[model samples]
Target: MEWLMYVSVAIIAIAFAVLVFYIIQTLLSLKKTMENISHTVDGMKSQVDEISKESTQLLHKTNELTEDLQYKSNTLNSVFHAAEDLGHSFQKLNGSLRKVSETVSKQADDNAEDVAKAVKWGSVVMSFWQKWKTEKTTKQADPGKEAN
Candidate 1:
């Protein structure tokens, strides 16, 4: 009976030791896993910070681009307005030229007969002046004798 009691105690002690070893091993594994997770979380935090900075820069650049586009669009609007004004001016000039041309045409049409009559009167006066000059020269050249 004394040997049986010692064997039972020994068995119980061995079982308890095995259980404690396994518990310690489990705790160590859990600690290692927790450390890995902490490192991963830190890495993720750094990546997030970098991404946040990049996104902020991207947003600022986008705003600047939007402002530049708006300014260029405004400038283009003025150019369009200038083009429209030039077109209007050209149209007005064309209209004025057309009106002047039409007036000249109308005046020429109204004065065509008067112009022809004036040309005919000019020709008749020139013929009379030429004939008078020739007669006077002939009389002067033959002053000593009567001219036939």
Candidate 2:
């Protein structure tokens, strides 16, 4: 009986020792894994911070580009309007020029016969004036000259 009691006590002691050893090993492993997880989480946080800063800069750049584009678009719109106005002015000038050209052409057509008659009369009058002047000058040189 005493031997049985001693053996039972020894067995119980061995089991408790094994259980304590495994518990300590598991706890240490869990602690190490937790530390590794903490380090990984800290690295991820730093990367996230860098990404946020880049994102903010990108947003600012995008805003600046948008504003610049708007300004250029406005300038282009005014230029387009100016071009349209220029086209209208050209159209009006062309119409006025055509009217003046048509009037000139019509006047020329109506006066063609009158212009010809006037030129013929002018030539006849010039010849008569030349003959009269020569005859008077000769008469003045001689005392009495009859222009036959």
Candidate 3:
């Protein structure tokens, strides 16, 4: 009976030691996993910071581009306005030319009959003058002829 009791006590002690050893090993492994997680978090934090800085720079560049585009658009707007003004001026010039052409046409139409009458009168006067010159030449050639 004394030998059996001693053997049972030794077996219980051995089992307790084994349990303790396995617990220690699990704790060590958990510690290593925690360290790796901490390092990964640090790396991720640095990468996030870099990304933030780049994002800020990109935002600033985008703003600059937007401002430049706005300025150019304003300048282009002025050019378009100038072109519109020029188009208006051309339209006014065309309208004035049209009015002048219509007025000249109207005056020509009004004077057409007067111009024809003047041409007829000029022809009649030219015929009388030619007849008078011919008579004068005939009288000069024949000095003793009558004045008829």
Cα lDDT tens digits for candidate 2, 1-148: 9999999999999999999999999999999999999999999999999999999999999999999999999999999999999999999999999999999999999998998999999999999999999988988888555644
Task: Compare candidates 2 and 3 on TM-score and give the better one.
Answer: 3
What C-alpha lDDT, on a 0 to 100 scale, does residue 97 get in candidate 3? 100
Shift in Å, residue 123, candidate 2: 9.1
How accurate locally, in lDDT, is each candidate? 0.98, 0.97, 0.98
Report the error of model 2 at residue 54, Å: 2.1
C-alpha TM-scores of all predictions: 0.65, 0.64, 0.70
Q: Measured by TM-score, how close is model 2 to the native structure?
A: 0.64
Instruction: Name the runs in model 3 displaced over 4 angstroms.
Output: 1-5, 116-148
**1-148, model 3: which lDDT tens digit per residue?**
9999999999999999999999999999999999999999999999999999999999999999999999999999999999999999999999999999999999999999999999999999999999999989998999888654
Candidate 2 stretches with Cα past 4 Å from truth are: 1-9, 112-148
Backbone clash pairs for candidate 2 read none
Between prediction 1 and prediction 2, the one with superior TM-score is 1
The whole-model C-alpha lDDT of candidate 2 against the native structure comes to 0.97
Give the C-alpha miss distance for residue 9 in model 1, angstroms. 6.7
